[model samples]
Target: MLLCWLLFIPFIGGLACWFVSRRNPDSNAARWIALASMALVFLPALSLWFGGDFSLPSHLSASPDWNRELSVPWIQQFGIAFHLGLDGLSLIMVMLASVLGMLAIAASWSSVRSRVGLFHANLLWTLGGVIGIFLAIDLFLYFFFWELMLIPMYFLIALWGHEEYDRGAHMRAAIKFFIYTQTSGLLMLAAILGLVFAYYSETGILTFDYNQLLGAHVSGTFGFVLMLGFFIAFAVKLPSVPFHGWLADTQANSPSSGAADLSGILVKTAAYGLLRFTLPLFPEASAQFAPFAIALGLISIYYGAVMAFAQNDMKRLISYSSISHMGFVMIGLYAGTFLALQGVIVQVVASAISTAALFILAGQLYERMGTRDMRQLGGLFGRLGALPGFALIFVVASLGMPATANFIGEFLILFGAFSVMPWVVVVASGGMILAAVYALYLMHRVYWGTPQGQETIARMRAREYAIMMALVVITLIVGLFPNTVLSVTQGTMNDISHWFAAGVIAASQAS
Candidate 1:
């Protein structure tokens, strides 16, 4: 019911936007229609968060359980169902998705004048698919939405992106994105089917339901292999080191809104999958894999920070910064403690908003100066009025400044991870230094030295101001009162943490 409508509104509205465009090409009608659609989607997400019992009750089983669910048989012969569920974890994610979706639309309004309808149609569709990802409880259904989301994003980059001063820049980036994600998706699909068949062999029940499959016994070498499949898929999506080739290129070329969705929400899905599926689905394998995973998190942190410092392109710099921020998130996830997990959730939201605001700022700079090369940007700080100051605040926030959400998240992640992997946390903390170096360097190059661009600088418009300020307010709220998110997600994090603990115990007993 409520869950179904959440998915329905954005998808249908996407089509409506296309139709609106068809009727009147080059009109603002399509933009408003798309905005309205995103608005409609937000209402339901709000209701679900405020109106539902988000906590995972103590009486629930060892498996992570949903607080509210709706199911209808879809492929009975194969035991597939159109299952949708919501818990505190997903409730917060859905709400973030909707809020960012609207802001992305607002950010795009003036920049996408040529193909307003098509641009927004893709936007809404991408948001719809993301929402579906958050809600789908059936593995088959989840994979469907997962792949579904990427298509519209391909169109977004291919059609509206800025990489091409030449003919095929956007196409190259889009193709690379498609190939990378699609290949990873195939690997994930193989693993999902592997799990299903594994369960069927043990109990003679063919099912793709998350809860049912969770109860199936999966361990040993074969279980480890399947877990690797799932982990690789999530890691690539997380764009962990050695597998992050596509991220910088895609974000560098993408339109502001596309980059926003990519940095803010799309990447966050990888973290969600790790939390919701990777650890819980194969806890023993995940626990066994923690040390290596923590090492990789440390690598991503320094790697991203170093690359961001070296980059001249604004979008690429921000993309790499995202990699650095997600590194902390990765550490929290693998730490497998309540405090660390709590930090993971907070960091996810905070990082998304901060990165999104930067992308939006990049777009604004392009609109004024017509280039994102930091070499060509300097001393426009005074010329652009408060934009320089705004950029300063966001840059500081990106570096995990106190009273901002990133600080709270990074602090908790370090605090919790220290208990389990003291040496790793100690090494990873060096990334914060790198973060400050690049962040301040970015600000200095773009705003302090001298106005290097040939074009005139412009002040922030009402629309742009609104978009940035809204993100600013959200980040401040999360930073000032993280308890709102922590309280909502506590029960579920407890369940997930406990599940990993149980897995470790069970593995020890078996050994």
Candidate 2:
């Protein structure tokens, strides 16, 4: 029941915001309503985190032990159910979404003045869709939420995005994002249907229930093909390497809040999908494909870092840097060790915080400076009170500075994976050096050089200060005491690792 509320509150609040805005376009009612709605969702998730029992059972099983679950028949003719479940993995994701959603609203409070109500409605709806993606247990429901999130995001980018010289650039970026994600999403849909039909042929039952389908005897070429479909979808969403063309443009053009969501929350959904569905559903195929996935991860890491180093646009730089960060997540996902998997969880949460903070900071810088090009702005460290210092902290965090969450995540990933894939870990380590170069280059170009203009920039506002401080605190706490995050996600990560290992063993024996 609470899971349903968590999923529905943002949606209901979005509609309410739209209606409230229609009635009072000039008032702050819509913003407050959206904030309250997120608060409503966040409090429950926080309670679950504190109060829920997430300890790993002494005896592990093929099936996961969900802390909470709800299932109600929906589309009975097609064997679909309105299924929702929460484990530690999902609890953390939802909480992240809630926290980021609220901050995104605060970040946009001043900049988005035209359609205040509609802007927030889209924001809340996009978040609602993301939460739905995290919670949905039925494949059909998952796909539904997956597509649901994209439309509002399109609106977000197209409607409120930053317009440089060309007005249509944002729209083009939005459409490109939609087409890439939607087309890949369709492939996943086809794969889902193919799996369902395959199961139906064997058991005369047509169902999209994740638990039931998990036992579906899928293997051989058919299984691998289905897995590819799902993998491509997630990769595109993950925006890995070749499939990542849409991300830089989209992030560069999107409104700051939209970029934060894109970088922080939306991309994590791909990692989640890989963990929750792709590996678990077609473990053998995933294992077979692990080498290729790791190779792509390597490519994305180096490619993103190189591209970021070459970028003058601050947003594009951050976007490419995110690609590099997610590459670590990709490697962690496929490493198939308990430690590597735990690192994936931490990296996902930590990267989301640090990256989102940077995007928000970039947005703030743009608001005051009237540009995102690093070449156009310099000597900001002394001019912008507190903002530059905050940027420096997050920038260093992005490069996996010691005592930060990024370091813990990357260290665990590399160390854990080295035991399994020493050569791959060794090669990936070069990315750390490249990351430092680009991160520092970003600070130097934007903050340490001669002043491009002598204009007096406004100091950080109260809201901006609060948001940055909160994010900084989160990054440090998670960095210093990752156990807080590790403890909650350990059980889920362990279960996933076990499931994948069993599949690996089965595949090996069969081979």
The TM-scores of all predictions, comma-separated, are 0.97, 0.98
Q: List the residue pairs that clash in candidate 2.
A: none
**Clash count, one per candidate:** 0, 0
Give the TM-score comparing model 2 with the true structure, all chains together: 0.98
Best candidate according to lDDT? 2
Task: Please write out the lDDT profile of model 2 over residues 1-511, one tens digit for every residue.
Answer: 8998999999999999999999989999999999999999999999999998888778776667789999999999999999999999999999999999999999988888989999999999999999999999999999999999999999999998888756889999999999999999999999999999999998999999998998899999999999999999999999799899999999999999999999999999999999999988998988888999999999999999999999989999999999999999899989888899889988998889998999999999988879998878788877888999999999999999988999999999998899889999999999999999999999999999877667657999999999999999999998999998899988888888887888788778878
Error of 1 at 367 (Å): 0.3
- Stretches of candidate 1 above 4 Å error? 164-166, 452-456, 509-511
Model 1, 389: alpha-carbon shift in Å?
1.4
Which ten-residue region of model 2 has the weakest summed lDDT?
448-457
Instruction: Please give the CA lDDT of all the candidate structures.
Output: 0.89, 0.93
Model 2 lDDT, residue 377, Cα:
78
